[model samples]
Target: MMISETLNCGAIVTTSQKGKGDLIPRAKGAAKLLRIPYVERKRLSLANLQANHKNKDILIFSQKGPQLFTGEGKAHEFHLSMAQLRLIAYDRGETDHLVEALGPEAISSFLDCTAGLGSDSLVVAYAKRSCKKMVALEGNPLLAYITNYGLRHFVHENDTVTAALRRIQVCAVRFETFLQRAKDDSFDVVYFDPMFEVPVTESPQFLSLRGHLVESGFTEAILREAKRVAKERVIVKERPFSSIFQTMEPDELLGGKYSRVAYGVYKVKG
Candidate 1:
């Protein structure tokens, strides 16, 4: 999807009130990269800037990190709490459903088609130590930019987490486009975590993400492309009750019996 289509409310890049000397250049660089305008904060509040810009969304660089403020008053930033918790569990020799779905073989390359906030990708990188090449694709420009920056800079107590973050390469392109251009058997595994058809209403994070998402669905064509690109397997993450299971009819299903989510796997090669 194009930037204009995804961010129809339009967007401008700026620095936070606390951000002055150093953040200014970074904000300007982000604006240039996104092909959007850079507005001088001048100590102006986000609300005041929103009012002046006719309520367009704002991407702000600060001493803390990058944050995206939607025109509708929603704010989003990258956080590693989810991935951290999972990693902690893994350290205790617990099972991770996604990793379990990848099978017992070592993975050399992995492709994440829908890398929302990259929580899953981070876990995979850290757990699948054999995976040397990991690429994550996000269609939304705003999401792509913030996530890419966060993965590279987000500080973590565990050096393993920090190292995992650095291992992923985030690209600002739709998965369909990337998959189409990719050569056959280019990756050891191809994974998709499309936004759930039924929203997890209780989760505040999902609610916030719903507004900014580009909103793509799982389809047979995409599954075919992913299968072609993956040497070993193509996996789809979805709610257990999702209709995609009926339509796609994956070769195997991997997840706990009571788990809310499931991984549908299609083996491509032995």
Candidate 2:
């Protein structure tokens, strides 16, 4: 069944896929468009949803356990969920280089040209250490809505998450529109994670239904636009051996257990 039809706007429900329960949900009217597991059973309510966002209560849906926004604030709440499969990368300590490459001191502002689930943006927010603003651009409405909801609920609790979110701005429009809205080289960094073709793994749940529920492909146009809009650098994440994208090569590569962090520290010539 469609996840939205079973949900109510502003109500909190525990989601179930395949008859399993325990994903947190609020009905922000995107249930049909987004495929989030928002249901309207008796156990769901508005106060619970509010509490989930406020960090005053913990919601454990299914087996995902307790995932608080843990971000710095409103601006930083813009993000993607790090599901079990992706958590493998985080567990092996790959996220640290992303934190190091951007750095705590050198960065002050970020524009996520490809803010999928806002995960990359959230991480950037957490690591910015000194950043005051993060403007995220997402092409998917469903993912955008999910990310926006997350920001509103949980980002205000942690000092780092709140601080980063304080500077967060979201454009629910396409990346090209976002690119047109910005001046050339106006930001300290413009990040990209254009979807790459990867072999289907056992972990389909790790992929958001807002994204392709099935394995899928991303476009070259998105990469081209990312280079054009970024002021300081363009970072692309992909599997090490994929070799399909035609974008600029990284000034350096940050090693990961199963992937390579390809990044270009951009510098425009006068």
Candidate 3:
């Protein structure tokens, strides 16, 4: 969803603290970036929600980290389930298709053009322990905030996983804008996981993420820029039968027959 749409519906950014004056300044700063009003409350309570913004939807900056409440009692928070899945697959000695397509060991620097909740980005970062740098660009401020918070704070039983999560640098910026300024071969690989053009009932995670998303579907311009910025390869993830894949015509395709997800790859030419 667009930021304007979110603000128009009545939203305020604040801290969950009961009376933390120090948090107010930071909350206000983030509020400015999100273009939402800033309000300070001693405690983030149901009564406070009913009183302050008149029960408007809330974006809270707290000790636990960033979160968005739809006001319908549904809370949107970042989770590292995908990253953890990758670790499990690795333990079983099975390779994720995205890693198979990217040629894992060759990836030292990676760029994720559409970060969303940063699941895919975290997956690759965790898989390639030799990776030196991993940057994920998220266009939506709310998602970026929540994802960044998760990356920094989420703890795993494995220290390596914790280190991998910390290695990612999440930035709130549009993919096209980032690509325009990115130098040639700026990263060893670039990745995109655009929202599907057609709805898939199987995708409950995306369905639950309705209004919380920015609508930047796959586009030729994005792919072109990604190719220019990536040194070795660019990968796009989408449903295999999606029309976008027909036009995308990736140089290499990965994912099993029973798998619903597909990867479209483009290798940079010499």
Q: How many Å off is the CA of 141 in candidate 2?
A: 1.5
lDDT of 2 by residue, 25-111 (tens): 333234433433344434534344445454321112334322222122221123345532343454476566556556344677788
TM-score of each: 0.93, 0.58, 0.85
Against the true structure, candidate 3 has what lDDT? 0.76
Q: Is candidate 2 or candidate 3 better by lDDT?
A: 3
Query: Distance (Å) between predicted and true CA of 142, model 1?
Result: 1.4
| TM-score of candidate 2 relative to the true fold | 0.58
Candidate 1 segments whose C-alpha is farther than 4 A from its true place: 1-9, 71-74
Q: Rank the candidates by lDDT, best first.
A: 1, 3, 2
Q: Provide the overall lDDT of each model, using Cα atoms, as 2-decimal numbers.
A: 0.84, 0.49, 0.76
Candidate 1 lDDT over residue span 1-270, tens digit each: 112223322689998887877899989977877878899988888889989998777898978788888755357888874777899999999999999998887899999989878989999999998798999998878878788888988879988889899989888878888999999999999999998888766657656557677678889898899999999999999998899998888899989989888999999975
For model 3, state the Cα shift of residue 42 in Å. 7.3
Kindly report which residue stretches of model 2 are placed more than 4 angstroms away from their true locations once superposed.
1-80, 83-95, 103-105, 155-157, 199-205, 208-225, 244-247, 257-270
For this target, which candidate reaches the highest TM-score against the unseen true structure? Answer: 1
Indicate whether candidate 2 or candidate 3 has the larger TM-score.
Answer: 3
